[model samples]
Target: MMNHMKGPKGYETEGPRLIFEKKLTKTNIRPDQSRLLMPFKSLIRNDFLRPGIGAILVDQRNVKVGLMLTRWDMKKNSGGGTLNYALTCGSNDIVKGNRLKKDDDISFWSFRCHNVICFALVLPP
Candidate 1:
């Protein structure tokens, strides 16, 4: 996790730690798929997430997008204890609203506002 990093869209340079950043892939923007996969290697910390709980994230425009933090356990099927995570639920709306295309760079930042966990999706200039 990166702390005290500059935020996108001229946000404060004091808070909003960066969790991960990646270029959009076809799977992320496909309407049929809808979910944005967070590869294991890219995840900084997931301790802030609660199981089965959905979260609302804001974009640079302050548009709210609901997303569910989900984990896929490989142990149940493949007998491997590895786990994978993804952001689901309203991810498609985020993609549509942001006009995200393949290879478009985006970043996820985490912060706490009024004791509530908040996230922001940032687009590269």
Candidate 2:
């Protein structure tokens, strides 16, 4: 059986750290597995203004696994907005079932409403 250990107060023992530590390479990550992906320049630039563009979350294979919906809006902290950076993960049932239980590094790219491409390398807690 998998031995699970508890970390700090707000941390998971075995989470998405593999994705963060692993370099960004072209790997064959299944949608049903936990993975992360990077976005193309064009796709990144268009995400901000066009809500339809949606938020794309990738796996190690550079394949999009999930889309950020209301969560994106929640990040808008103007009025009742969480005002936090919008980061999301996408994947199938298996991947979702085994989400990041601990803090992990995530690379994100998105366009602002002003058509400015924004990039962020973050460790989600």
Candidate 3:
């Protein structure tokens, strides 16, 4: 029996059993498991990011920078999820997220909660 440990995202057990999965690559990660083809980088809890919340990535001092959605790890305290910097579009290259802060304009949407709202930001042209 393989040992299981608390991991980011979900359960961090052995990459499932061979009987359960076929064609193993990269340790135990299967091609069918996730849609993320690129390598993922681990993220940690910060002043703005609460683990497991959908986050919008933007550059410092700019609001119009390309926005991408990312999530935190399932295990709040220990585990953190992944993101690919290559994906952040044209605003400015985020070297290290020098200025990541929570947008108070938005609030935390917890797990199993499907509350969503719409707002508009009209910038002067």
Off by over 4 Å in 2: 1-52, 69-81, 84-99, 110-125
Ranking by lDDT: 1, 2, 3
TM-score of decoy 3:
0.19
- Top-lDDT candidate index: 1
Best by TM-score: 1
lDDT, model 3, position 112: 17
Per residue, candidate 1 scores C-alpha lDDT tens digits across 10-103 of 4544346778789898988999987887776677766665656676678766787777878766465656666667788888888888788999
| Error in Å for residue 102 of model 1 | 0.5
The 0-to-1 C-alpha lDDT of every candidate, in the order given, reads 0.73, 0.32, 0.24
Clashes of 1: 0
Question: Cα deviation in Å at residue 43, candidate 3?
Answer: 1.6
lDDT of 2 by residue, 32-58 (tens): 433343322213233333332344343
Off by over 4 Å in 3: 1-41, 45-56, 69-86, 91-125
Task: List TM-score per model, in order.
Answer: 0.74, 0.29, 0.19
